[model samples]
Target: MTVPERPVRVLVCDDQALVRAGYATIFAGYGFDVVGEAPDGTAAVRLARELQPDVVVMDVHMPGIDGIEATRLLAGPDAATPAKVLVVTTFHTDENVYEALRAGASGFLLKDATPDQLVEGVRTVAAGESLISPSVTRQLIGRYATRLRPSAPAPADDGPLAVLTPREREALTLIARGLSNAEIAAELVVSRETVKTYVSRILTKLDLRDRVQAVVLAYRLGLVSADG
Candidate 1:
């Protein structure tokens, strides 16, 4: 018999009690475990370190450390055992979204997102996938690609890109352009399974955690242009 998966454990953090309650209710209804709740980033971090939830639904504007700093502490490069963070906020501007991503947020969602979207966002992050709203992908990453470049000069010779085959490069480009696996399959005239394999190989070769990191790397490495 096939084994069933465990319910995703989630921690909800928001200054508004109503918002936290609403998200907790939705997650519970979806069979997720609402492990804890926090009204501020400091508490959020403390609870996250304590509970070690699979996913953290974080808000950006909370007082006392705010979400960005909290995310960095919980999920950033220096984190001892990073938790996946899905940043939910009212703002959709490039700066806010980009900063959250830089702080190691696994995903970004708007507070106005539908219940279905919120549930899916939590599941996505918990499953080690990343979700950025399509609008944020287009508006923030596509429009502001140059801003994503690093201050240091890029290597002159073949670097990480050299590891990927041509087809993997093509797949990476489409992923950077915000195409889903199914969409990429259709675009490349291949089966979805084939696309999945390519994506898996790409991620392994590039040592990327998920599509979010891949998208950011593509931009930083100039694999995908800002215009298209």
Candidate 2:
């Protein structure tokens, strides 16, 4: 069997010892290079700056600094190199999820995810794609809908995405709601294949790398408000 080359470097951060150990073992099994492990957000940030890992698997609720804040510091708008952050947390509706996303996290994953899912999440983020659990994404839209700040100015590239048709916008909103292609098709009365095509177009028009980036843009551009 051909072994997959080790190209992705990862930093694991969590307050609990077992969580870190579990992640280290799981990720290592997939041929990822576990560069370092941190027990809190403060250390996570410092280590990220020092190690320059390809991806940071951050926990939302750490003792000091917190994963959201650390993610912002490392991947936020002002970050120097901005390693990709993939939040792994236990609370599905934690307030930190939004903060992390706004802080430029590439994706979010629940701690209860299957081992296979965990491996996939790391690989997805390392490959420059975003992955958010469907359940959590829906919860995020509902929880933050009332708090969304649509008045925020759109980024420069935002206008270019206006090329999407009205239907496409609908698809985008549902995507932000964390609906899968089948779910979206059911809601829109379209075929699953159609939803897939729309998703592809949306990603292309917005120049997004994947669904995760699309979610970030949807929020930043006020297409899907926190209140929506």
Candidate 3:
């Protein structure tokens, strides 16, 4: 007999007890292992470090360190072994979303998200995928793209753009434009599998964690303009 795969380990962090309980129930119902819960950022960070969960469902406005700082501690560039963080907050402002991404969150979602959305968000992050909500993708990234800067200087000869071939660069641009793999395939007259391959290659060459990071890098490096 084949052994079943392990469930995704998740840590839920929120200030509201009711909210925490709701998420725990939902996660458990969906076969996710609800490993821990925290009412504040400090506790969240402590638990995350100790448990090393696959995904952390973080709240942005918690007391003490808050989700942004806690995310930084767990997933930021300085983190030794970064865990994927999915920020869930009632606030949908551009600043909050941008700050959370800068802190190394793999994705952002509104607390008002449906149960399906929430469950999928957790699973997506656990699977090493980014989960920026569609609404956030359309509004926040467009409004805040100008505020992002490349993490490192581009080299004169080729720079970060050099690592990607022309087709890969095109795929990255389409990703920045928020096109799904299918949409990209339609646009380029290529197979969906081809588009998927291009996306994977782009991520690998850039050393990016997911598509969300790729979007950020695209804007920061002027691969796609903020106006578009």
Q: How many residue pairs clash (N, CA or C atoms closer than 3 angstroms) in each of the candidate models, in the order given?
A: 0, 5, 0
TM-score of 3: 0.90
Alpha carbon lDDT at 8, candidate 3: 93
Candidate 3, residues 1-228, lDDT tens digits: the string is: 999999999999999999999999999998999999999999999999999999999999999999999999999999999989999999988889889888999989998899999999988888776788866864467556557555564542267889888889889989888887889999999999899899889889999988878888787777776667
- Across 140-202, the per-residue lDDT of candidate 2 in tens digits comes to 644444355356556533575578888998998888867777899999999998988898899
Off by over 4 Å in 2: 1-4, 142-146, 149-160, 163-210, 219-228
Misplaced by over 4 Å in model 3 are: 1-3, 150-158, 189-193
Question: What's the ranking of the predictions by TM-score, best on top?
Answer: 1, 3, 2
Whichever of 2 and 3 has more TM-score, that candidate is 3
Model 3: how far residue 188 lies from native, Å: 3.6
Worst 10 residues of 3 by lDDT: 148-157
Estimate, for each residue in 121-178, the C-alpha lDDT of model 1 and write its tens digit: 9988887778997557554765555686767636422578888888888888889988
Question: Between prediction 2 and prediction 3, which has the larger lDDT?
Answer: 3
Q: State the RMSD for candidate 1.
A: 2.1
Error of 1 at 155 (Å): 8.7
